[model samples]
Target: MLEHAFVDQDGLHDFVFGGDGLSSRYDCLVITSQRAVEAVGAVLARAPSAAARARVLAMPAYTVGPATAALLASVGFSNVLGAGDAGNGSVLADIIVADATRQGALRCIFFPGRVRKDVLPQKLRAAAAVECDERVVYESRGVEGADAALRAALDAAGGAAQRAAPRAARTWVVFFAPGGADAAAATVAGRRLPAAAIGPTSAEFLAARGVRAAAVAAKPDPASLLAAIAAADAHDV
Candidate 1:
């Protein structure tokens, strides 16, 4: 079983749709997460003219993976490409580079959250050698502490004992982001528990705190997360 120790806090403010050195159209629009897609959608929905929406919809949208791509589709983006199975910035950068090479030099507009790795833009520039512009649409913040539900579950599970004997316990903590890893680490204190990470970056964060990830998901999606949990459980068995 997997337990969520942290909740997401929306850090979106100061919306800038156009202007400020941003172009209305680009060769590609990159969205790193579902939150970024939603943030961009909110800005586009407030456009004064229908043509503005249409222009954005017509642009080629690239995402970290299926989840973000699905969110982009829901927001009326016509063409969306997912970064295959691995939902990481590096993988997405590769795909973007390949596309740009096939179509010649391209301009890219990135809608990324505040707490994002510089890997995407850096890799895109180096690989594709294109002009990339980043617009900070939203920010991701971690909850200060564990919620009531998580606290109650930890109390019921006998805290340290449950973590000490992973083979006898099926409960595991899943971290989806670095912020979540930090918050969960503070909440759990020094109790060693089986942990799973959504990607390599999150896994590294947890590893820094002395919590070795039992499994790391290939992509940051529900199905991939479940697969990671299953792999962790297999080790217990």
Candidate 2:
């Protein structure tokens, strides 16, 4: 049922309204980086000053999550707000709509990875004539050939150990995304290894093949996955 991605909009709307309104030079921009804030911070630092730079520099950042907000803060951009503890895109989108209503004109530049969904920008543009732009900073290519070959080899060998006599094997299946879910399923399909999913999305992906997705984490990230695995172990005992 999940559709869109999580974007962070920290105090960006407040900065917009607090500023001298929308600049005739250019207005607010909403940029997102699912890849950690450090990555986005680098992009922001290197981005040319010509293509709506000052606008981004002046406005408070709306990020994809807390990591991104922290990255912005690290880079010295103040007025960040959106994601406080609940770091996700849905919450940020709601904040964008509410803030835009009070601010009048809101421009945005959304920076996304290769796998981002388009619901937020679509919804925001429909609500207001916000100056929104899409910028891609990095791309994710599929793992193939020797690199993937090594991983596949590891799975094939480890998969047997994972499935052995004990159903409660210590094998940990780290699901990063929908694709990662598929990969994990394929790797341990016939094996009796226990799995720990990253989120509902990955769970759904596994469930399609009749695999009961247990130990789902709070979020679809590495740290969350690790936490979920630990919790699952505790519950198992």
Candidate 3:
């Protein structure tokens, strides 16, 4: 099983956009992560007037997961829509596309991190009925001293680097996104530590780094990812 040994916290180093044109031009907004929600909340906190805050909050918000939707509600978003079963960028895109087509909504503003998958925006751009205005509200950087932390975590977790680790005592690192691949690979340099990717893009990313993922989740959700890992474990057994 994989834990903090292969990854670490993604800290939001900067918050970029304040709620500028969001209230007037866009009928709906797209938000992907909890960090993006926090960025929006910060902007709303600094809004000049209640009217400005209300205007921004009144617009319907489409988000990646239920957690994000709940955060939107807490931050005064009146209409919050979320990806129903799958919490990923692609599913969020589908939800946006369907809603845009049904409601005849045109202008959309996406509040996302600097390092995110392009699928939602790309799909929105490709759709005929929608025009997405992407705004970078935040930038995230990997935590400093993460590589050392990963090594420490592995060392604490029964020495994955042990040369005589049993054949059955396989070690795997599960990557939730492609961003963590390089650092994780470097930490497990000489070990045959298998990997499980959250989706195809991450799996491909790992593959490019000369590490093949033993499991690739069909959808980017916890259940699917865990299921993929369980299936892989079964196959190897």
* Best candidate, TM-score: 1
Cα RMSD to native, each candidate?
A: 4.9, 7.6, 5.7
lDDT of 2 by residue, 77-192 (tens): 66676745334455567778777778886766566654555666777767764656665544444454534564575567576765666545466655555555654455556554
Candidate 2 residue spans exceeding 4 A from truth: 1-31, 34-40, 47-55, 126-131, 146-169, 177-213, 219-223, 234-237
Model 3 stretches astray by more than 4 angstroms = 1-21, 152-171, 182-185, 188-190, 199-201, 216-224
Q: What local lDDT score does residue 62 receive in model 3, on the 0 to 100 scale?
A: 88
86, model 3: CA deviation in Å? Answer: 4.1
Ranking by TM-score: 1, 3, 2
Ranking, lDDT, top scorer first = 3, 1, 2
How does residue 27 of candidate 1 score in lDDT? 74
TM-score of 1: 0.81
- Which candidate leads the pack in lDDT? 3
**lDDT by residue for model 3 over 150-236, one digit each (tens)?**
877766554644654464556667787666765576675555556788777667667777778889877666788888888887878
* Per-model CA lDDT versus the true structure: 0.70, 0.57, 0.71
Over 27-82, each residue of candidate 1 has an lDDT whose tens digit, in order, gives: 77888777777777776776657775677677888887677788888899888886
